[model samples]
Target: MSDNKSNLTEYLTPLIPLAPVLSVKSLSFVTSKTKKQQSILGCSNKLQLTSGRAAIAIALEHAGIAKNDEVLVPAYHCESMISPVHWRNATPVFYKININTSINVDNIILNITPKTKAIIVTHYFGFLQELTSIRAVCNEHNIILIEDCAHAFFGSLNNQVVGSIGDYAIASSMKFFPCYDGGILASSTRPLGNVNLKKPTLIFQIKAFFNIIERAIYYKRFGIAGKGINALLKVKEWLWNNIKSVSGEHYTCNSPASSDGGYGLEEDWIHKSTSVASNLIIKQSNTKLIIEKRVENYQKIHEALSGLTTAHPLFTKIENGFVPLVFPLYVDAPEQSFDVLKKQGIPIWRFGEYLDKQITEAFCPNSTALSAHVFQFPCHQELTNQELNWMIITIKKTIK
Candidate 1:
């Protein structure tokens, strides 16, 4: 192993001795006031499952968006977000991103026609977008505002949650929370009232159950799993391609998000605060130790890379609660840096690399720039100090 890898292994190996092994019994929790309190705070009554598209579907319906309506979306989002607009028979008007990597839409709004009904603003990478300005513009035009809180679960801007600012907000519980799957569509100003859920297909429920089992097994064997999932996904893709039609619409804030209760839950597709996820959310919510460690590691990595010519942090540190998803480094030449890091056995990712570059030409200049320039290092809760140091050293050595 390289010195950095060896150092990381040695550092983590000792922690394994001190750490308690995960047991099925320990995973179980006793009923308590704290647990009950968590359920109340976490939108326990409001969350539901869609085939993973509940958020957008709810937003589209609440906004009264109709066929051929246009909804503006950030050019820098996952392709899944656009599926709702297409499913609704509406068009997506792409908007550019600013240098700060926040949504920029001055040009997009100028081009907005009578068909434009709403805009979906994403708080990318947990950084709260400048929604105050966007809300102001939307109000003037009598356009609805939808906040994509998929990446901003606990994130807030100026003491207001991202989901609270807009006319409607949607979030996926699986992204930030420890839950396997679920999404929430919430409103503050308007009443969502009660939504009736359609029964999910039996095949989807079976597949979701097996997929969870497979993911658990892979995690146990490989430390960080999902390789088996990719193989399974390929087979699924092939089958889907041969098939002519699939029941139910794709999940989105604009459409009624579809749900097949994930894995075990068949009766309800929405996330009911399970004893398992409730505890995990509580544990992670007040994660002072994890957050501090990550912040420290981020500082070290930033300090070390600040001197490098091609590597630099993406945002200012002074922003309110600007916790990083990972320590991001923007390289002038990404493919070269990626190869150099890979050769050294460091795992890295070109975050959101799958975004449609061609469609981006409509708006999103900064999103396009970031797509080619930035790479993420793993800074999830499991990271250790040794791993952080090794990562810093690896970056210092790899970057010219």
Candidate 2:
């Protein structure tokens, strides 16, 4: 809930990044400040929050989910998704997903009860799931659909952008944009009541902006700019030590604040709005190149990894409306390669890795299999040619 200053070594970034890392040059693409961007920010009936889980919590509240109500959540999910249901005091009935991780509509139908009031469907890896059947089923049962678009903030299906199709939808802007903190709750079908929020304190706001620059330098992102930041950081360190020696003050966080999204829902920041800096970045930045570059990078991985014996892509084709958040790959043996790939500094993540204990292999076979095998690699707009090539080569080498 505090600053998302993950220690320099978290999987968030390998020696290379697994997601978008901002640099000074990253802002150059923000061509217009005043023009209304055609992205999700342009949508009406949307509320911004500090993180995606916060939006999920709000979606639960606004969907009229009360205590002990059952909300259909995928068996394969991070704690972020599960925690919000707990926060609402509602039971999360873990539904089985199809092999590709789409909702198993029959499972949903089987699981529904009078207490079941809603269903949450994720647009996994930015590939939109075919939701027409799910929508109809929800309508027939009168269950609200909470579309989770954390991996998908852009692109469209049936001529309507994502996050607008469901009765309620939420997105994680930090994944798509260069900013540190942002999430959106949007609905086209229902008018969203305004979520009153107090601005973050000036110091926190400053840190929110600075954390972007610091994270880039932490990952050694820009060629020369990163090095320059490293040099200045050395000077600052020296000055700080000298000052500490003189003032007899040395601060230490035995446990620095961690866990921004996945650990659990933080009620403290749920009411807080996005910082001013991130809101500006979200609104000003153009996404045309961002989308095109993401698609291009995803295409490269699909073409290169299609032939791998040890690993294969989860989605074979980047469908017309698909915009990827990461290259979702299923390696044959995570026990053999997961740690090795991490040690090799491959920018990879497996959202389904630390799934809830209640979700057993016997309970949900596809979720169990997908949880162990499916790994996500960076396919963000900020990926460099070298990083892309290196990750591809490393993954191929490590797995095979």
Predicted structure with the largest lDDT when compared to the true one? 2
Off by over 4 Å in 2: 1-13, 29-39, 225-262
For candidate 1, write residues 1-400 as lDDT tens digits. Answer: 0102122432222211111112232224434432332111244234454422556765686577879899988776665577777766788877777756677667657757889998888776556776788888888899998887765555455766557777877765544333344566766676655655554354444444444445444334234444665567678767765563454445322112222111111224342322233234434343343344445655667677777777777764625554444566788888777666765666564545556655464455687777768876655444456656777777787777
Compared with the true structure, all predictions reach lDDT values of 0.56, 0.79
Ten-residue segment with the worst summed lDDT in candidate 1? 14-23
List the candidates' TM-scores in order.
0.67, 0.88
Q: Lowest-scoring 10 consecutive residues by lDDT in candidate 2? A: 253-262
lDDT of candidate model 2 versus the reference: 0.79
| lDDT, candidate 1, at 189 | 72
Looking at candidate 2, what is the lDDT of residue 383?
A: 83
lDDT of 2 by residue, 1-400 (tens): 1111233354433667666777654566565542333345556788877778888888888888889899999998877888889999999998999888778889889999999998999998898877899999999999999989988988777776777668888888888888778888888777777556666667567667767767788776776878887788778769868988999986541110121333666677777788888888777656776787899999999899999997899887898877888888988887898777777777666776777898888999898898888888888888889888998898888888
